[model samples]
Target chain A: MSTTSSVPDAHEGARNDQAPAPAPRGPVARPGSRLLHRWVWLRLSLLLSAPLAWMVLIYVVALAALLITSLWSVDSLSSEIDRTWTLDNFRTLIENEVYRNVTVRTVGVALAVTVIDVAIALPIAFYMAKVASPRARRMLVVAVLTPLWASYLVKVFSWRVVLSEGGLAEWSGLGSPGYGLTAVVITQAYIWLPYVILPIFAALERVPDSLLEAAGDLGAPTSMVVRSIVMPLLVPGIVAGAIFSFSLTLGDYITVNIVGGANQMLGNLVFVNAGAANNLPLAAAIAMIPIVVMLVLLTAIRRTGALENI
Target chain B: MTLSSTARRTLAVLTAAVLVLIYLPLLVVVLNSVNPNQSMTWPIEGVTFEWWRRAADSAGVREALATSLQVAAIATGIALVLGTLLALALQRYSFFGKHSVNLLVILPIALPGVVTGIALNNGFRGILGIDLSLWTIVIAHATFCIVTVFNNVQARLRRMGTSLEEASADLGAGVFTTFRLVTLPQLRSALLAGGMLAFALSFDEIIVTTFTAGGGANTLPIWILNNMFRPNQAPVVNVVAVVLILFSIVPVWLAQRLSSDVEAAR
Candidate 1:
C-alpha cells in the first residue's frame, strides 16, 4: 500500500520539478527531498546498514569463528590454537566419558525443566488469561513479570539458601534434596517458570472466548473442548515456552554451579575448559552441543509459527 | 470457558499456590538479609541490621554497582539506536532477506547466552586480538539486548503505520522534520519501555558478562556470585539481593505502565 502511494507522489514531484518555473503553490519542494523521496532503496539501506553490520560482524562472524575454532586443535602446552582442521575435538567429545555424561546430563535437565515449566505454566496461564477478571489478570501479570526482573544469580542463590543442608527444606521437613541434578532442575524450573507462562498466556489471550463457547454449546465436555480446540491452538505457545526453558536450561552453568554439588553440565564444561583450562577449541566443541540442539529445536518449531510468537 | 465450580476453584488454588512458591525463595532472601546468622540458616537466630549496614559500607559492592550501571547504560544506548533503526527498516521496507534480518536480530537472544558469550570471547581474544574488559561485556550485552528493544519498537512501529509520516511528507515536511516531529513523538513511549527493559536485562545479566568481563571486571551479578559463598559475606550478599529484588520492581512496573498507557491511548 505504501509502495503504491509513494510512487505517484514521487512522479508528481518529478512532474512539478520539470515545470517551467517553481510555482508558489501546492506542497513546496523541500530541500533534500530528492534524496529522501527518490531513492527508496537508499533510505532502506541507510536504515538497515548499522544494525546489519553490527549483527553480521559481532554475531554472525563470531559464531562462524567459534565453529571454525571447534574444528581446529589446541596445543596443550602453549595453549595456542593450531588452526589445523581436525575432528579431534569432536572425536574427544565422543570418546570422553566425562563429556558424554555431561552432555546427557545437560539435555536431561533441559527436558525436565521444559516439562516442569510447561506443566506449571499451563494451569497458571489458563487461569490468568481465561479465568481471572481483568483487574485480577493485570495484577497477576505484574506478579509474574516482576520476578523476572529480579537478578538471575540472586534468585539462584536464594534457592541455594532454601535448599542448603540445614536450611528451609530441612527445617520445613521436606528433607532437603541437597544440591545436584534435582536441585538444578528445581531451581531452573523455578527461575524459568515465568518465561514459560507469559507465552502460553499470550497465546491463550489470542484464543477467542467465542471459540470456547461455541465448542461448549456444541455439547463438548470441557476436557474435550480443551483437548480439541484450546490445546491444539496452544501448541505454538507451549512450544515457544518449551524453547525458552529448554535452551535456557541447556546453556545455564550458573544455576548448576550454585546448586549442583559435585555435578557438571555442558555449560560448566564449556566454562571450565574456556576459563580454567584455557582450552577454547575444546570449549567451542562443548558449546556445539547446545548450539546444535537449539538449531534443531528452532527448525522443528519454525513450522509451528512459534518463532514469531516468541 | 465452561468449567465446573470445582474445577474453577482448583485452578484458582493452583495459581495462588504457584504464586506463593514463586515468591518463597525471594522471601527467604529478604528474611536472610535481616537474619543474624551469617550462614543464613533457616529459623533465623535473631534480627539484625548489621548485614545491611555492612553492605552499605562495602566498597566492593559500590564499585560493582557502578560498573554494572556504566555497562548497562552504554549497552542500552547502543541497543536503542540499533534496534530502532532495524525496526523501522524492517517494518517499512519490502526488501530481500527481510526474514533473515529478523532471524539475525533474534538469534543472539534466542540462542543460549553461553554460546554467544564464549563465541564472542574467542572472537575478541583469538581473532580480534583485543583484551577483554567491561567494554567487551557491553558489546556482548548490546548484541542480545537488541532483541528486546527491537521487538518493542517493531511492535510499536507496526501499530503506528506510516500514514502520519506520509502525511507530513505530503505537506512538504523534510524527512528529518517528519521523523523528529511526527515519528519520534509516537515512538517516545516505546523507546522508553524498550530502553527500560534493555537496561534491566543488561543490569541483571551474568552469563554473558561472565565470559566477556574476563578476569578483572565485576558486574553486580558477578559480585554476588563471587561473594555468595564467602564466609560472613553471604549475609551481605543476601542484603544486596534483597535490595536488588526491591529495586527491580520499578522498571518492570514502569514498562507495564507505559505499555498499558499505549494501549489505553489507542
Candidate 2:
C-alpha cells in the first residue's frame, strides 16, 4: 500500500521538474527530485543499515560461533580449546546417562511448571477478563504486574525463607517438603505466573462476548460453550504462555541452586561444565540441547501464529 | 457468560486466594527486613530498623547500586535507538528476509538466557578478544532488551500509518524533516514505555550478567546473591529488596500509563 502510493508522487515530482528544466532561468529541481525517486532502495538500505548490522553482527554471529565452538573439543587439564575438530562432545552426551537423565529432568520440570501455570492462569485470567468490573480489572492488572518488577533472586530467597525450617509451612502445621525438585517447580511457577496470566487474559479479553451469547442462544450448556467454543480459540494464547514458562525454566540454574537440594538440572550441568568445570566445548554441547529443543518448539508453534502473541 | 452465583463466588474466592499466595513471600521479605534478629528465622522475635540503617551505610551496597543503574541506563539507551530503528525499517518497507529479522530479534530472549550468556561469553573472550566488564554485560543485556523496545515500537508504528509522512513530504519537507515533525510525535509515548521496560529488564537480569560481568563487576542481583548467604547481610538484602520493589512501582505504573490498555502487557 505504501510503496504504490509513493511511486506516483515520485513520478509526478519528476514530471513537474522536467517541465521546468532546460530553461536554466531558475535553479533546476530535476536532479534532486529525480535522485530521490531513483534512490528508494538507498533509503531502505539507510533505514535498515544500523539495526541489521547490530542484530546480525552481535547476535546472529555470536550464536553461530557458539554452535561451531560446540563441535570442537576442549582440554580439561590444560584449559585450552583444542583445534582438532571432533564430535566427541556429542558422542559423550549421547553415551552419558547423566546428561540424558538431566535433560529429561529439566524438560519434565519445565512441562510441569507450564501445566501448573496454565491451570492456575486459566480461571484467574478468565475471571479478570470477563467477571471483574472496569475499576477492579485495572487494579487487578496492576496487582498482577507489580510482583514481576520485584527482584527475581529476592523472590526466590523469599521462597527460601517461607520454606525453611520453622517457616510458614511448618508453622502452619503442613509438613515442609523442603527444597528439592518440588520446590524448584513451585518457585519457577511463581516466578513465571504473571507472564502467563497477562497473555492468556489478553487473549481472553479479545474473545467477543457475542460469541458466548450465540452459544447460549443455540441451547448449548455453559460447559459445552466453554469446552467447544472458547477452548479452541484460547489454545494459541496458552501455547504462547507455555513457551515462556517452558523455555525460561529450561535455562534457569539459579533457582535450582538456591532452592533445589543436590539435584542437577540440565542448566546446572551446562553451567558447571562451562564456567566452573572449565570445559567450554562440553558446556557448549550441553547448551545445544536446549537450543535445539527451543528451535523445535518455536517451529512447532509458529503455525499457530502465536509468535506475535508473545 | 452463563454461570450460577455459586460459580461466580467460587471463581472470585479462588482469585482472592491466589492473590494472597502471591503476596505472602513478599510480605515475609518486608517483615523480615525489620526483624532485629540477624539470623532471620521467620517468627519475627522483635522489630527494628537496624538492617535499613546498615544498608544505608554500606559502601559495597552503594557501589553495586551505582553499577546497576549505569548498566541499565546505557543498555536501555542502546536498545531504544537500535529497537526504534529496526521497528521503523521493518514497518515502513517491504523487504526480503523481514520474517527472518523478526525471528532474530526474538531469539535472544526466547532461546534461553544460559545459551545466550555462554554464546556471548565465547564471542567476547575467544572470538572478539575483549575482556569481560560492565560493557560486556551491557552488550549482552542490550541484545535481549532490544526485543521489548522493538515490540512496543512496532505495535505503535503498525497502528500509525504512512499518510501523515506523505502529507508532510507533499508540503515540501525532506525525509528527515518529515520524520522529525510528523513521525516522532506519534512515537513519543511508545518510546517512553519501551525504554522503561527495557530498563527494568536489564536491571533485574542475572544469568547473562553472570557470564559477561566476569571477575570484577557487581550489579544489584549479583550483590543480592552474594549477600544472601551471609547471615548478617541477609537482613540487609531484605531491606534492599523491599526498597527495590518500592522503587519499581513508579516505572511499572508509568509504563502501563504510556501504552494503551494491555498492549504493554503483551
Candidate 3:
C-alpha cells in the first residue's frame, strides 16, 4: 500500500536540483564514505541491542528460575524453602501412587476428549464448509464459536449443576454420574469443541469446491471422495486442533476439580501443591513435565510443517 | 449417487439432535436462573427475574465483577503493547534466534494454564518474595494473553508484507514516526481484535487466577466458584454466569466480524 504512495515522492526527489544524482559505483567506495557507512552500521546495531538483549534476558531468567526451583527441596511441615538440590521431588512424583494415577488420568482424559471432539467436529466442519447454505453456514460457525466467549469458570461451574443429580442429565433421562472421570471428559469435550471446530472449518474452507465436484462427477462414492480429497487436505488442521485440545486438557485443573471428584490430574496436583502444601519446588517440577511434552509435540509438528499450516 | 430423501431427513434429525445436546446444559442454566422454586426442577416452575436482580444487588458479586474487569483491562493493555512490539520486531527483522523467540512467545499459550500459574507463582512468590495480588493476576494473564495478540498481529503482518514500512523508511520518516503513521494504522483492526480477544481470555481465566490471587483478592470467577454451592448464592451464580457469558459474547462477535472483514478483504 505504501509503495504506490511513495512513487511520487521518489520522482520529486529525483527532479529536485538540491539532491545529488545517484552515483554508480563498483565494489569500492571512498575511504571517508566507507568510514561513515561503518559508523552508521555501528550506531544502528547499538540502537537495536538493548531491546533484543532485554527480551533474551527475560526469557532466560524466567525459565532458569523455574528450572532451578524445580530441583530444590521443601520442608514438609512448615513448607519452608530449602536450598539444597535433590532428585527427591522428581522421585516422589514418579514413585507416588496418587501422582502416577493423576498423570495417567490427565493424559487419558485429554486423549479421550480430543478423539471425541475431533470425531464430532470434523463432520460438522465439513458440512458447514461445503454443504450448508451460506447463511446456515455462518450461523453454525457463530453458534460453535459463541460458547468460547463464556467465562471459563462459569462454564465449568455450570457443568457442575448440569452433571449433578437432577440436573440437565437427569432431566434428559441420562443418569447424572456426579463428579467423576466421565463428567470431566464430557465437560472438557464441550469446552474444547469450538477450539477444534474453528480450525478444522478454516482448513476445510481451503479445499477447493471444484475438487469435490470433480470427484463426484467421476462417479466417486461420498466416502471415497472424503477419504481421497478432504481428509488429506485436513490433516494439518486436525492435528492442530488435536494438539490444542490435548494440551489444554492436560494443563487444565479447574474442570477436574469441579467435575473429577477425587481424580487428581497433574493440574490438580500442581494446584494442591502450590496452594495447600506450598511445595513450590514439587509444583514447579510437575509443571515442567507438561512443558516438555508440549515442546516435543510442537517440535514434531513444526518438522512436519503442520505448525505453519496452523 | 445422491442421498435419498429419507437419508437426508435422517441426517438432518441427527444434526438437530447433536445441536440440542450441545445447547441443553446452557439452556438449563438459563431456565434455572428464573425458576422460583428452591430445587432446579426440569419444568422450572413460575419464572422470575428475581435472581438477576439479586445478583445485581449483591455487593460481593459486584465487587468481584469490578475487580475482574480492572485486572482484565490492565492485562489486555499490557498484552497489546508487548505482543504488537514483539510481532513487529519478529516480522520486520531477519535476526539470529528469531525462531526461538517465536517459540518462546507461543510457549506460554500452549502450556497448560496450571503450569503457567505454578511457574509464575514460584517465580514471583518464591524467587522475588512478592505477594500475589491483582497485579500478579494481571501479569499471569498477560503472559498467556501475549500469544493471542502476537498471533493476530503476526498474521496481519504477514498479510500486509514489509513494503509499507520500507517505503516509509525510504521517504526519510523516522522509524517511530513511520510506525505510528503507517504501520499502526494498518494494524488497527488486528490490535482491536487482539485486544478484545485478550480481554476475553483474561476475564474468563480461572486456573492462573486461582494460583496468583492472594488473600482478599477475588475475581468474579473465583467468587462464583466459592459461592456456587451455597443455596442463596446459587441463583446469583447463575445470574453472574449469564452476565459473563453475555459480556464475552460481544467481544467474540466483534472479533468474528473483524476476521470475516479481513478474510473478505484478502
- For this target, which candidate reaches the highest TM-score against the unseen true structure? 1
Best by DockQ: 1
Q: Candidate 1 docking category?
A: medium
Every model's DockQ, to 2 decimals?
0.57, 0.49, 0.42
Distance (Å) between predicted and true CA of A308, model 1?
Answer: 7.3
**Clashes, model 1:** 0
Question: What do the candidate models score in CA lDDT, each in turn?
Answer: 0.87, 0.84, 0.78
lDDT of 2 by residue, A1-310 (tens): 1232332233234312334323221121245543553466776787788878988899889888888888898777787889688999999999999999999999999999999999999999999988889889988988998898888887898888888877776687776779899999999999999999988998898889899988888888889988998887787789888988999999998998888989888878777887787787888889999988988888878866766555
Task: Give the residue spans of candidate 3 off by over 4 A.
Answer: A1-60, A295-308, B1-11, B256-266
| Cα lDDT of model 3 by residue, B114-200, tens digit | 876787788779988999888888877887788789889989999898776656645544345566788999999989988988988
Sorted by lDDT (best first), the order is 1, 2, 3
Which pairs of residues collide in model 2? none
CA lDDT, candidate 2, residue A14: 34
Better of 1 and 2 by lDDT: 1
Better of 1 and 3 by TM-score: 1
TM-score of chain A of 1: 0.88
Residue-pair clashes per prediction, in order, are 0, 0, 0
